[model samples]
Target: MKQPNAAKQHKPLWTKAFLLTSLSNLLLFFSFQMLIPTIPTHISQLGGDDAQVGLVIGLFTISSLLTRPFAGKALDSLGRKHVLLVGLSICALTIAGYSYMAAITLILAARFVHGIGWGMSTTSLGTVIADIIPAERRGEGMGYYGLSNTFALALAPLTGLWLMNAYGFLRVLQLSTCLALLSLLSSLFITYPKPPMPFEKPAQRPTLADRLFERSALLPSILLLCTAVCYGGIVTFITLFGREAGISNVGWFFLCNASMVLIVRPITGLLFDRKGPEWVLLPGAFFTIAGLLLLSYAHSEANLAAAALCYGVGFGSLQPALQAWTIARAAPNRRGAASGTFFSANDLGIGLGAMALGALATYCGSYAVMYRYSVLLMVVFLLIYGWCLWQAKRVVRLFGRTSN
Candidate 1:
């Protein structure tokens, strides 16, 4: 028999879509991170306490989690570009609303609305990428895509703080709003490949398993969720915790963390592409566990720097690995659903962790207590990650046996 022609293999339209979508995500996340370091301070300015700040941030995750399934369905039925435009428009409007809202409740409501838009947009983008990139290259592609957001993380917060100090909060808000609008403009340039048509009969919808999982999906999704809980706690409260510990310029911590992620993410992505997730994930988890533990006892600026380096390396490496793994396991037609499932798990973990950490902080009367608690949570996550690694090895062995 003639060998199949490898020359006929061509880069698909989906790859182009992923590139544009990644750019859009980068701009959108840049706008978001610009606001991250300032949100708590804004809440306080509007007469909200730490508990209220927690609610405001936690509610955004809740809104996103609640709408993710619907967004997935919409991606299947409505097409990616249509869903994306609607989401970006709404996100821009809600963010503008946030700029003007003075009441904590109104601000929370605006954030919740923004979260809905975020859920829809990001879900559609991931699905669009899945439709474009090849399965074997998914990990590498996803890692490249993730770097866009990582770039935003590295720069946005520090810029925001500088603007806040140099000018005023209103000026910072204006800059943020401009970035959101820029994302909207960039998104208009993104084109999606033809989406799978909607099911003719709503009742004939595929089961969740048929939509989200086929082979290695479950393990990666679970791992991402666990990591998200760790992420949520740190991003939401790290500044406050640092301030409480007498660390001035807490924005520097975010700066350092994001910078490290931007630097390390590409190298890790290459590693994932070559050696596979098993090699990257175990060490990633250990780094994260160490970071959280160090953060628990951190007081001096030097300790904070150490913790940021550890977190940047660990969580930064793991996120792209998990995302790529989840997409790699799903059928081509079901990539949107798989993305939805992954993001939903992520949203839930972050939401729950923020709420719990907030409550703990309220009772304990110190942010250090929250960090200590997070260390304990990381321990649990480490144990679970170990079990997942064992299971993944067994699955590989079984597959090898069957192939023989």
Candidate 2:
């Protein structure tokens, strides 16, 4: 009896399904992250300006925003494997198309379609992970899973840039397409868990609101959105900003960021599991704020690496913790919707940040100033999160009084 109880207590988190899923996610992110910094550079090489670059990122995110809600519903209703396959196919095809197109308009069109694939694939993968991971060890499992993204971040940008510099943008695009194909292939082998409540029939079909979003997941989504705005700014413009600051190799920043994230993720995950999000989020936010502030002034590679380290810890810690929070707050049956809501919010934030901050950079004529301005969003995040905590405490106290 004691052995059985201990075995149940230690239910495996790293099952074959989880490993395959993580591998799929890693490869997908490698494809995605490899393109992120290089795309803006590609546009520049094609005689496109900064605004065009912004439009490219914005359009991709907007299309993703449009697709994620529907994808979430499909994950719940249609099942995970089919939705994942469809999404991966779309991603693979669209990514391959980039190498053939020279016109900005064609690339933009492709980007819109690519966003749909990204929305579906990411939402399905996240939902599947939530389904498979044990409830008790969700934070830890998510942390480990997110290491894929961290590793991708560590290697993808540098690899992409190197390929682009050595051979050409065509080579970079070719490699990215290959990576996407590999990710798609890897996903085909995963054994997905059945959706919760498969046998239960509802009295009424779900409304659009019910299909699109989960109310329970909103707080964490909102919190995630704030940080994502800042993230969007970084992802879209950091390479150009590196040039503006006269740094020869901006790739090192990603390397440093990923390195720090690799170190911080496990520790933060353990802390989140043992203590709570508050223990991680508050300090994480501070670190992010400091990192951004430091980045605003970074002129040397060392300074850039320092900024990345701080930002990495903050961003890395906050993301998984928020994801875990979203999953924990949601009903098992609604996990798909919750994942969609969370990712949709993330896309929206990134879109907004890319568009708005890109314009701001244009207006100010300085990337450094733009980064400094982006720090305000993080400040807003901290304020809103703190207010939520205070409100929660007040509600608890009121409940105590009512009980008396």
Candidate 3:
């Protein structure tokens, strides 16, 4: 029950390492986002249809999901730095490979390879941070880390689109490859902390409760899954949807959305550190739900902009809170597994949601239908979470009474 002492805890070496790692992730994500706005269009240019585009995008996620458990276990055994370097190097190479391929199949292969690298890098970096950051400040640290990616998400797509318009897709691809290489190089400067070994003895097996509940840890994980599902719908289909709705300059909508996230994330982090996640969750959820609704009804550029602001605020606030909570409740030895689990759920929600939404859009003849469906899903998640919170409080009260 004793909380880590804030005054006594020194600035951890892993914190600096995590900052570098986060920067690498930022660049990597930036490069990917740069490609995102153009990828479907490129696939179309290459004579692929919507189904093929969906397949290509889905391949990346499928590869990532399949590799995560292995990546997590490897990070636990092989150490973080080794896995980090391997992942980043592979990522850099894959980005370069994109330039050499015009075939849809080859592009899908490259994305799959990129997904493997993403799985390794993300799992290792998260595990390494878990080893370094203090529980009390974990929320704050994770928030800052999340901000790095959000910053990239904000700038990368617009910049990439502009460059693509100016110089061409080939030149944009070259820029992305260079950024990925920079990310790979950045890993060399990161000094990863030594992670604890896995428990070996039969008696050292974690309890059923530890495996199932993770108690407070489940809070963030569930919230993350919900948020990811919502985000997946927007990120994957919004631009295409906008184009369908006869909106011009769909890229600007993404730019505004990312900008709002970048602006709001740090403030949310500060709030999480001082006020706890409970206070932040409801408002964030509201914004997201509202954003999705507005997006569904968006008939003008102004409506799209308003939706972006709402969506950004919602997403920016909740993501870090969930990450911090997941790490905070995990035992140090199992933190890698815990982070993997968290990310697995996140990946599953996002990947599945996108795929399903794509299918729905195909049949429904409107992206708005998908948005409405997601709003329903969000409502379900909120109900489940609310019930869980109530149950948790009841258990705590009962335990306190029995103890007394």
Candidate 4:
């Protein structure tokens, strides 16, 4: 790894840059999230079936996934502030465009554009936080930075649903655009870290390898894909899933879910920094497995909320823990690449999961049955995670014995 930037200095956690950037993250996420539930409903309103709904939802993720590799390179080469503002501008325009789109094809097209904005903005935000935070405190800092989104999560679902109910899809799209604009305005105030000077003379042209992906972060990114697959199922269908059980509002579940995430996010980050991934992830794996199992059987508000609490705690802790691991292992100069790689894997899994789960729901004739498959995926993830850990230990022991 390159030597840590000599300029990195100890600063208080809540600097103006961090605060403003966090606010920007919060607002951007709110705008993006407000459409999550509403969009599927809107697709249905436009005469799209569940399969078509999945296609529209999944396309956004596919678009973002395709762009993340390029966005990562841009974060490193272009100024963070510039990339950020451009992303916000795109988000503002694309969100407003949704209001004008009546056909399913048009909505899908708009979602694709919107995903590009989402991919760039989120990648930059994570990289910006990494640039500013102290290395020793990165786990904690990432967890705290994530709080902006998690806190926003607490409100976005209910508010989005409420807007849809009160003002309809068109107005929801309009209000979502306003939120994106606010995110852009807040980003304008964020202090961009001084751009790092490249250690070597610039190449005339970069190769495909450098532009494509970050190698050091691949392990964590792949692992995250496993978890994100299950998360996608929840994000894409939980509203309709709840309605399947006679509950019209999914706010309570998200409320409980976000609350648990809010509570554990910082603590798990601290634990990851202090005690390492083994301790933090073991419990997380258990929580995730149990949560999915519970969710598959949810039939009442109480049961649904209980499932949310479990999933939230698991997901909340694991995401930052894994992200810290990704960035921690990466060379400082390539953190933007790491962030991009991580989020790309994240979006890929979500997109595929939504599509696959939706198809399964269609074949099986209900979302509840599809969730049973999500539970199985979670279990498989834990098994894979455990096997990888065991293999790592075996490799370490053999290397030690050889050196001896």
Per TM-score, the best of the predicted structures is 2
Model 4 vs. true fold: TM = 0.87
Instruction: Residues 1-404, candidate 1: write the lDDT tens digits.
Output: 23443533333424556767787888888888888778777888888987898777678778888777778766766677888788888888887777778788888888889889989888877787776666556666777788888788778877888888788777777887787788778778766678765445447776865544334455666777778877877877887887788887666667667777777777877687678876778788888887887777788888888888888889888888888877766655556677788888888878767767878888989777776776665566667777766776787798853210
- Best-performing candidate as measured by lDDT: 2
Q: Spell out the clash pairs found in candidate 1.
A: 14-132
Q: If scored against the real structure, what TM-score would every candidate get?
A: 0.84, 0.90, 0.87, 0.87
Q: Give the Cα error of residue 255 in candidate 3, in Å.
A: 2.8
Ten consecutive residues with minimal summed lDDT in candidate 2? Answer: 395-404
Error of 1 at 219 (Å): 3.2
TM-score of predicted structure 3? 0.87
Instruction: State which candidate, 3 or 4, has the greater lDDT.
Output: 4
**1-404: candidate 3 lDDT, tens digit per residue:** 23445454445534567777788878888888888777777888899988888776788888887777677766766777888789888888888888889888899888899999888777777777667666666766777788778777778877888998898888888999898898888878987767875456547676744443334455567777877887787878877888887887666667778788777877886677677766667677888889889889887898889888888888877787777767766666667667777787788889877877879888898898889878876686678667766776787898853210
RMSD of each: 4.0, 3.1, 3.8, 4.2
Local accuracy of candidate 4 as per-residue lDDT tens digits, 1-404 = 33444334344677898888888899899988888778988889889997788776677878888888888888887868888888889999999888777788888888889889888999988888888777777778888989988877778866899999998988888888998999999988888887566677656776776666888888788778888888888877888888887766676777888899999998998788777776777788789888888887888888888998998889988899888888888777787888999999888888767778889999998988888877777677677778878887787898853110
List candidate 3 stretches off by more than 4 Å: 1-15, 198-219, 243-246, 362-364, 401-404
Once all C-alphas are superposed, what RMSD does model 2 give against the true structure?
3.1
- Pairs clashing in candidate 2? none
Quote the positional error of residue 48 for candidate 3 in Å: 3.7
- After superposing candidate 2 on the true structure, give the runs of residues whose Cα lies further than 4 Å from its correct spot: 1-5, 40-53, 102-104, 198-206, 243-248, 362-366, 398-404
lDDT of 3: 0.77
